[model samples]
Target chain A: MTPVLIVENLIKTYPAFRLGPVSFKVEAGSIMGFIGRNGAGKTTTLKSILNIAHPDSGSIRYFGQELPGNERAIKQRVGFAGGAVDYYPRKKIADMIAVTRSFYDNWDDEAYRKYMDIFSIDPQKSPRELSEGMKVKLNLVIALSHKAELLILDEPTSGLDPISREELLEIFTALKERGVAILFSTHITSDLDKCADHITYIKKGEIVASDTMESFITGHSIRGEGRNLEEIMLHYEKEDYREKFAE
Target chain B: MKNLLNKELRLSSHLLSYLFLFFSIMALIPGYPILVSAFFVCFGLFQTFQNGRETNDILYSALLPIDKKDVVKARYIFVCLIQIIAFILMAVLTALRMTFFANATPYANNAMMNSNPVFLAWTLLIFALFNTLFVGLFYKTAYKFGKPFIAFIVASMLTICVAEVSHHLPGLEFLNTSDRLPLQFMLMFFALVIFVFATIISCRIAQRNFDLLDL
Candidate 1:
């Protein structure tokens, strides 16, 4: 299947850290789990893909078109939900939806209302009043309502309860069934294990591994025993640490 | 562009309403034209900077499909619209004061208290200078808000102080005389040109800086 998103040699530098030369791709109808330790540049890479942060040097192709140059076109078909929902705190949920809805020509009011109803979000409530899980739900509602073909989320399940997290995974599965590609960065490995078809692991700003999720688990398992995604990630983390200490 | 402008307007609606109320109250004070003008200019500078300070807004807009250049342009356009609205309201208040109350006022002998073209020119110059400094500093610092606001406040106060002192100088005394109405009109035109040029330059600078900004 053709890839829905591709990042090649992406690099971004800050005063104290650098993320870079990283490459990955998400297929059109699969879930690509971007797993990394804290401060491992997952958010930076995601931001670069969205052009929220300008890359030092790299190429980002969305649906076969180069980014920034094709930013408007690509962004129209892609939906991004960051880790936190820091929308206008003083404005009501309805006000935010109204403003956000105006920006997209393909915004589906029915989808928005459906998700709002499912999440039990009060349109009259201020953003500041919503719980952390509700905030994530609100972001998801905004993203999915726009008829986005690709969804790029950063640490989306971080604040959710277990049940909510499970429900979110089900939502992702449903989206995948409809051929909508997903690339989400998270520290939550079990969530990935449940829904991700592909897994890409990053350690200290570099891609350590990228492959089919089953192969990743099998390769990292011990003595012909199948290991969970978290154990596999821990194994890689240990290897990374050993290499750093060895040098 | 329209969507971006709409977002700005909606986000800053509270600030706009506050300004309207403050300006309306100031208009009721005797001999308040210059005070109203100064407040109008300063309020616009302060409010626009405050809007930019909201990190939520920055993050929200970044998620949108619009270019960063459009974000900067929309903000500048919003600032201009607010300034224009405030200016018109101030002008109407000044005209009303001059028509109905200028002669009945306690400061009847004070020509400086009269609403005239010369006062309008001075107000335009002060507002232009404030915007030029505020917008230039704001974009240069990668959209930092506090520093530019404080700097503009200080700069405006100093400008107003200098203007007040210059009113007593022999060469500038004609500013208070009605016989020099043509000179006042000429000064108004020049001040407007400066305002327009400064606004355009500020927008260009902001666009360039925002393009380089990393969210």
Candidate 2:
């Protein structure tokens, strides 16, 4: 089957920074963890994929069709949550949902209620009243309610406590089991160790590696096996630092 | 588009914008620059956009299943809708002043911009200028609104000044006369045309700028 998403030769530029010609694929029914340090272009890549940030030149395709020509239709199948539910901060959660629901023909009210219950959300409360974790959950609830086949979440687990992060990872695993593809960006590699099937590692605006998680760890580990994600990441980063020092 | 418009109303709207609709009542007051009512009404709409920037409304809308151009279109439509509502209110009050209170000493002796079609025409022009300058400039960054808003204030104040000064011109006094119905109606028609044309152009510019925006 065709992958759920494909990005090819993606390029975006700023006066002091550049991201691209990046390329990656997200398969159906799998969890892809996008790992990058801060300002490493992970959010830019995600935003470009979602067309929130215009790419300088590239093609992003969803289910084998170009996104530019089929943005509305493709977006229908792709749900994106960039951090928490912070917009319309004074509006009740239900009121915000009422607005969001109108944009999706496939919006599932039952699913929304289910997530709300699972997340222990009070629909009458405004975003300002929610904790960061609760805000992220609310954002996730809306993304999932539209019956999206693919989810692009930027730092969805950031700002959560350990248990909340684990809980979010569990939700990602559950979504994967239900055939929902997910691409989430985070610097927290330990979270990836727990749940990610695939890892797309980005550094300095380029993909350093993209492969199955187990193979990635095995290939990068000191003894060629058994090292955790955090260790391997630290090892590689230190190696880069040492190389720069040598230079 | 309807879905986007609904989103704009429900999520992007501010209570202050609705409350500012009451500013249209200022048109009924004697000896005042009636065009100031139009300015306040536009200011009200500006509040929504200001609040939108503060709340990251564009990013929120961008996340929705709509085209970026559609987001711009929806906002333009919302702004136009508010302007139309305020215009209707001004029209009604102008009619009230012309008929029920036409001979009232206060209005007849008022040396300021009086309630008339010419006044209404000027009001529409103010809306047109605000929408054009404000929306167009705002889209250039799609985040920082200060420059756009400042540009709008300057343009709108200039429009108001010219409008207030027009009736005092030697032969242009008819603009202040409610009795010159045909000329006043003609002026209103041309103003309507300018308003519609300018707003459409503004929307097009905003759409282009927003499409290029990274946020």
Candidate 3:
């Protein structure tokens, strides 16, 4: 089956930093967890995939169609939410939704209401009135309302309580069951252990590994199925610190 | 593009920007430069950009399905709409001064720039300069506005001074009189051309700069 998203040898450069020749794939009915330390070019890679940050050279396709010429049409079927998007703190949530809804033709008002209820977001309140977890939930509500086939979320579980993180993980699992492809980036590997079918690990703007979660743990010679993502991340990151100390 | 404009108006625009449209009425005052009315209108539009930056409008819009160029285009259109609205009001006030208030002693003995087509032309020129300096420079970073706005203030104050000083110059006295209809229309036409041409150039530059921007 064709993957929901394919990014090939993507590269973007800055005066002091560079991201890529990074590549990854996200298949339908699956959740791909993108893990990287801060400033490891995770956000840049995500933005490049969305073309929010222009790439110097690469190929990005969604549903087997190139993103360049078919941006609006393809994006109509995709939803992105995270740090890059912020509400007008003074504007009501309903007002923000109205503006966002105007851009998508497939918006489902009933689905929006259902998510709002599940998330406990009050449309009358502004973003300033919500907690960090509530804000993430609100972002999820907007994404789900449009019946998005693919959801690209950045750090949705960051700054959330453990229970809230579990609830959000459940939502990702439910969405995957419904065949919605998800690509989320975060440093919290525990959340991935619960929901991610596949894991893509990045360090210093390079993909160190990309595979099924179980295989990733065993393939690293960690020697047990019971071993988890956090242990694996720690095992690799420790080597990074050793290399830095040696340098 | 329409959806983008609607988003700007509904989300990014500040209420004070709309209320400031009333500043165009300043044209009715005698012994005043009157061109300052146009400056206040542009200042009102400045608030919209300010609100956009505070709310992360650029990143939010980039998240949508539209091209980045369309985002820049929508803002240009919004600025033009506000400017055109103010221009229309100022034009009406100028007409009132030329007709019913033409014989009023305050205007007749006024030492300042009078309300005439020349004044309208200068107003358009001010708008043009603002678009060229303020809006064009803004897209270079798409984040900072204070420096670009300061440049616009300096340029506009000079423009207003020049317009006021023209009436005091020996051969340029006709610019303040209502009787020089043919010349005033010509000046207005020339200023209109500058307004359109400068704005188009500014938009093109803004689009290119914004396209090069990362966010």
Candidate 4:
């Protein structure tokens, strides 16, 4: 079977930075973790694959076809969630469902209702009234409501509490069990530990490593000490981030 | 193309039709002929522009399996649809005012508010046609060059003014004056034919832009 998502030498150029010379692939029915620091091109690659950001070079194929800009057939099979999924600030969750359902053929009302119940979401609350975790959950509920074959998640778990994140992980695990593919990119490593089968790690617009998640955790160690992941990984990345944040 | 038009309609809250209707009422009031017409054209374009910004989730839209041509086609159709409805309502209102203005109100027949129906119809048609034409061009241009928002609005306004002005020029009055069925029918038919051909060419141009679009 063809891979669900594939990018080859994708390049996005700007005067200050370039996002690629990057290639990666994710097979159907598997979860791939895209690991990179902030501004390390994780979102850029996602944007290129989805045709949100036009690539200066290279190609992205989704399920064996070229990703067309603003095409409906490719969008039909793909579900996307990110901070970019935000909507009218005053819109209620119920209003969101009512509006979004008309856009996609795959919208499952039953599934959407179920997810809302699972999250205990207030149907009447405006989007702005929701906590950050609730907003993320709301985003996921809409993405999952449609029977999308591939879910492209960018920092999906960033705002959730541990319990909510665990719930999301369980949902991802269930989606994988159903043979859906997932491309999840985040700064959080623990989120990848649960469901990711593949890993694509990038640094400064280049893919430094791509492999099975199991291998990455088992074989990699920086500093050869019991230093926490944040510290050890920072050293390996060879960048001092201390001054960017106050002690 | 039809499907995308339907999608744009839904995403924009089905407001263009209502906007056309609401602004048409302004025309029949007969106190502000040119003001009413300009209001409808300017406000309609502005509202449509806002709708574009609101529904501008192009990346999410790209997930669909359709081609870039169809995507651009749908957008152009939406712009045209909005302009057409606005022009039609404005034309009818102007005609009705010229017919019934004496019975309506104190301000009805004042030269400031009065207009010849034939002339009004032609002007409205041209304005509607060229306004849509400009939208197709500007949408593609705006996305491609990342032009500032204010500049895009200015360009659209300039085009609307030009198309309306073309209808009012001296020699063009013959096309506007025919009251006989065959002459009137032929004129309207030819205008529509030209409008449609222009739309098709505009669609093609927009599609080419989408093909190379940086977004």
RMSD of 3: 2.1
Provide TM-scores for the models.
0.91, 0.95, 0.96, 0.78
Clashing pairs in 1: none
- What's the best-to-worst order under lDDT? 3, 2, 1, 4
**Candidate 4 docking class:** acceptable
- Which residue window of length 10 is worst by lDDT in model 2 chain A? A232-241
Q: Residue A141: error of model 1 in Å?
A: 1.5
Give the clash count for each candidate. 0, 0, 0, 13
Report the C-alpha lDDT of model 1 over A109-169, residue by residue, as the tens digit: 9999998998899999987898776777788788889989999989989978898888888
lDDT values of the candidates? 0.76, 0.88, 0.89, 0.66
- Of the candidates numbered 2 and 3, which has the greater lDDT value? 3
- Number of the top-ranking candidate, with lDDT as the measure: 3
lDDT of candidate 1 over B52-156, digit per residue (tens): 566367678877887878877887787777667666766677677656765664435553434555566666666666666776677665557667767777777
**Among the candidates, what TM-score does chain A have in each?**
0.90, 0.92, 0.92, 0.87
TM-score of chain A of 1: 0.90
lDDT (10s digit) by residue, model 2, range B99-179: 999999999999898989999999989999888888878888888778888888898898889988989999999999877
**Predicted candidate 2, C-alpha RMSD:** 2.2
- The alpha-carbon deviation from the true structure for residue A181 of candidate 2, after best TM-score superposition, in angstroms, is 1.0
Q: lDDT score, residue B192, model 3?
A: 98
After superposition on all CA atoms, what RMSD does each candidate show versus the true structure? 3.2, 2.2, 2.1, 4.8
